[model samples]
Target chain A: MKLKILKSYLNESIQHVSKAISSRTTIPILSGIKLDASPNGLTLTASDTDISIQSFIPAETDGKQIIQLSEKGSIVLPAKFFVEIIRKLPAEDVEIEVRPPFQATLRSGTSEIQMVGLDPEEYPHLPKVEERKVISIASDLLKTMIRQTSFAVSTSETTPILTGVLWTLTNNELKLVSCDRHRLAQRETPMETVGEQQFGNIVISGKTLNELNKILPDQNTLVDIVVSDNQVLFKLDNLLFYSRILDGTYPDTSKLIPQNFQTELVLNTKQLVDSIDRAYLLSREDKTNIVKLVMQDQGSVEISSSSTELGKVTETIPVSRVSGDLLRISFNSKYMLDALKVIDSEQIHLGFTGSMSPIIIQPEGDTKILQLILPYRTTN
Target chain B: MKLKILKSYLNESIQHVSKAISSRTTIPILSGIKLDASPNGLTLTASDTDISIQSFIPAETDGKQIIQLSEKGSIVLPAKFFVEIIRKLPAEDVEIEVRPPFQATLRSGTSEIQMVGLDPEEYPHLPKVEERKVISIASDLLKTMIRQTSFAVSTSETTPILTGVLWTLTNNELKLVSCDRHRLAQRETPMETVGEQQFGNIVISGKTLNELNKILPDQNTLVDIVVSDNQVLFKLDNLLFYSRILDGTYPDTSKLIPQNFQTELVLNTKQLVDSIDRAYLLSREDKTNIVKLVMQDQGSVEISSSSTELGKVTETIPVSRVSGDLLRISFNSKYMLDALKVIDSEQIHLGFTGSMSPIIIQPEGDTKILQLILPYRTTN
Candidate 1:
């Protein structure tokens, strides 16, 4: 394969694909990035056993030449060294030529580097997805949904299905739910679908979603997602992200969220976040990470935590409004902080059914994003 | 102790002293930072037995009150949590009050944090150095000297003295030398002395110098350095840094550098560095980190490295001048890169004493900095 491409374009594409190349892969060729140069464009692909990523640089982009190809061929080069060398090459354009017997020479400026390449035929091919079952969603909204729910996915491998975020689609409404037993996060949004085929129980690994989020552009570009029997493909711009779906049904988290609350309070999100963060330091030292919030009748809340060796911390933040009964509840501060950070609102509404029941949090007027944290039982 | 200090001033002072608080120290009290509040100012000190750093914030500076002290006392607080808490406090001024039995309450805005503190008497006191044997040097030059020579210090503790930089003072010139057997770096600068003591062979650990370098101001402030029997004290403005000197006579590295050369080359420092850096990548794959430089009579040098499995790389960078006999020498590219990064010159002069002898590097027309790297023996 002989091709000349801009350094910046290649560097960015390599960075995107490198995220899928795992160092612990058992297959030798899986650790290398497969490059395919054709008359139309140049494509780079990298995969581990679970996920695959491919980025394409067209021959011409917006009237400017992005890649110049003299021959069409394919070769696989070690991702580790190739990525680092490409980033440090001291030239604007890099020329790559693959000779027989799998020898690739990369030339840029006064530097010429020759690296051994593997046969591209040994690399795994991307799984094909049905085009008719594709669903399109805005990239910006998809990233937000991933950020809001992915953190709640269980990191423990004991329950494999719980390590993924469940994606459910009913007609036009799309719902994402992630639960780690201790806490849960769910986000619902309206998306455009191709047909009246309602999709559900499609669980993608939270780690995979995070990688997809990083490569997705921040703009409002449309991303088409196609789900096969066991694999899901996300197509954005000239990039394709494919991941294997977890086998097994996700637990129903809908029953965990309560519809009504015995106590409710609305407060400034920044103030509450800051107060809990300070109290968290002491709670972390106690090894319980438990912070108590005591709601006052006069529209104020006291947040406090104590450690046997580090003393205690107490912070009082005024609430904008209060209703129902006054209550004191203890919960993990880290869970609360994580939920508060993703709620994009100045004021947040917090609902508590009781000290032992799960607490619900939502943006003041938005019902699309909901966070639930289980309270810790303590003898106070 | 009761005092109200500006958050920024307190935070900066805490940061400086916290460097000396080693988390792995065996002494329990050594992990805490000692805070002393007097009528004059507030002092923060942290020690790790080997090194001690103290930063003082005066009650008033430039006619503005920096610390308001209502009571005079001292206490030791846990450095890890205290430093992080001070940085995140949401107030311009923080009020700290100490109760009986070393209970400290820190109040800022609506947040109040009570932390258990250790008795100040249990903390190790800073070592005293003789003021009569003191020398003065510019802070910026000292930092430069540390940077130029510190990287050559032996990280292996087999020879403790080799892990420290040898500080020699003759007349009014200060010379610092560091070597790790393979390569050596020396920097010389002129400084003023309090007396004609003409001190020599004061070795301070490279690790201690690195911490001192981090706290030194960038400006040309004068720093007073006092050398005692086993301790070196550096006094800069309101800060005091004390470090234990390594015991043993440093080896003489003067004979290692050659005054005569069989080959000479003058080239752009950045160009040679970039060329060697690229070659280093390939050499690293071979597990030797060895790159060869071939001097051409046409005023150009070819840098190359090869790996049996990963092929090879060759880069030819043009030099402005070349003299004496043609030469081909191999050396560790990392050592060459490290030395080149510290030279303060655009063009560098390289002197080679045959293919096996050590190569001397100096900034063009400057004698203040000298770097020597040993050549690797190759069959070719």
Candidate 2:
């Protein structure tokens, strides 16, 4: 294989594919990146059994030439060294030539580097998914949905299914739910689909979603997502991301959210976030990470935390509106802070069913995004 | 103690002192920062035995009030939480009040934080350094000198003195030298001393100097350096930094540098650095980090490295001048790269005595900075 490509284009594509190359892969050939050169373009593929990524650089982009190919072949090079060498090359264009014995030579400017390559046949093949059940969404919107709910996924491996976020589609609405038993985050948005097909119970590992988020462009580009029996594929401009779906069914989290509240308060999001953040500093020393919020009839809330070694902190933030009954509730400040950060509205509505029931939080006038947190039982 | 201080001033002072608070210290009280409020100003001090830093915020500066003190007392608070709390406070002005039994209350806007404080008497006091031997230098120059030589210090604790940079003063010239048995970096600068007092063999740990560098202001302010029996004190405006000197005589490194050379090459510093950097990537995989430089009589140098598994890389960078005899030398590319990054010259002069002798490097037309690296013996 012989090809000449722009250094910038190759560097960007290498970065995207390297995210899927795990350093601790058991298969020796899995640590390398497979490169295929054809008349149309050059493709780079990397996988780690659970996730696979492929990036292509066309021969011509817009009116400028991106790659010039003289021959077509395939080879697998160690991703670790190959990526670094390409990034540090001193020239604008890099030329790569592969020999019969699986040896690749890369030349740029006055530097010439030769690296051993493995046979492309040793690499694993990517999983195939049909495009029949595909949905289209803006790349930025998908990134936001992942960021808002992915953090709530359980990090514990004891329950393997909880480590993934559940994706459900009904009619034209798409919902994502992530729960770690202690707290839950759910985000819903309207998506465009090819056909009127309803799908549910498609659970994807939160880690895979995060990697996909990093590679996705922040611009408003359309991304096509295809869901199959046990595999999902996300197709961007010239990139493809595939991940294996979890085997078990996701638990129903809708019942955990309360429909009505005995107490409700609406306040500025930043002010409440700052108040709880300060109180969290004190509670962190106690290791319980518990902070209490006392709602008063005067339309103000007292946020406080104390530790035996490090005194205490109390903050009073005024609420814009309050209703129902006055109550005192204790919950993990980290969970509250995480939920507050994802809310895009200036003001947030926090509702409490009772002292021990789950608390519901959402943007002031938006019902699409909802966050639920379980209260901690404490003797006061 | 009762005082009202500007949050910005308090936060800056706390940041400076917190650098000396070591989290792994055996003494529990050493993890706290001691705050003393007097009629004149508020003083903050933190010590970790090996180093101590103190910052003072005066009651008034530049005809403006910085602190308002109603009462005078002292207390020590955990530096970790105190620094973070001060940085995140929502108000411009912060009021701190101390009650009986070392309880401190910090109030800013609607937030009130009460933290348990240790008795100030338990904190270690700073060492007393007499002004008998002191030297003055520009803060920027001192930072540059440290950066140029500190990276050469030995990180292994086997030789404690080698882990420090030797500071020598003679004839109003300050010199710093550091060597790790393989490579050495030396920098010298003319200083305006208090008197013609010559001193030598004062070694300070590289880690301490790094911490000091982080806190030093970038402006061209004059810094006072006082040397005692076993301590060195650096005074910069309202800040004082004290560090313990390593016990032992530093080895003489002058003999390692050669005055005459068998081959000489003058080339662009950046070009040679880039070429060798690429070759280093290949050598790094072999665990030797060895890169060979062959000076050609045609005014060009060839840099190359090879590994059995990961082929090789060769780069040819043109030099402006070449003299003496053609020579080939191999050395650790990392040491050469580190030394090149610190030289403040676009053109560098490289001198070689032979294939096995130490090579000398200095900035073109500059005599104040010199670096020496021992060449590796190679079969080719």
Candidates' TM-scores? 0.98, 0.98
lDDT of 1 by residue, B169-239 (tens): 99888999999999999999877666666778899999999999999999899999988999999999999
Compute DockQ for each candidate against the true complex.
Answer: 0.78, 0.83
lDDT of 1 by residue, A1-380 (tens): 89999999999999999999998988999989999999989899999978999999898999999898988899999898899899988899999999997999999998999999999998887887777678888899999999999999999999999999999989688999999999999999987666676788999999999988999889899998888889999998889999999999999899999989999899999999999999888788777899999987677899999998988899989999899999999999999999999999999999999999999999998999999999999998
List, residue by residue over A94-187, the lDDT tens digit for candidate 2: 9999999799999999999989999998788899898789888999999999999999999999999999999999988999999999999999
Tell me, by lDDT, which candidate is best.
2
DockQ of prediction 2: 0.83
What is residue A333's positional error in candidate 2, in angstroms? 1.3
Q: Give the worst 10-residue stretch by lDDT in candidate 1 chain B.
A: B190-199
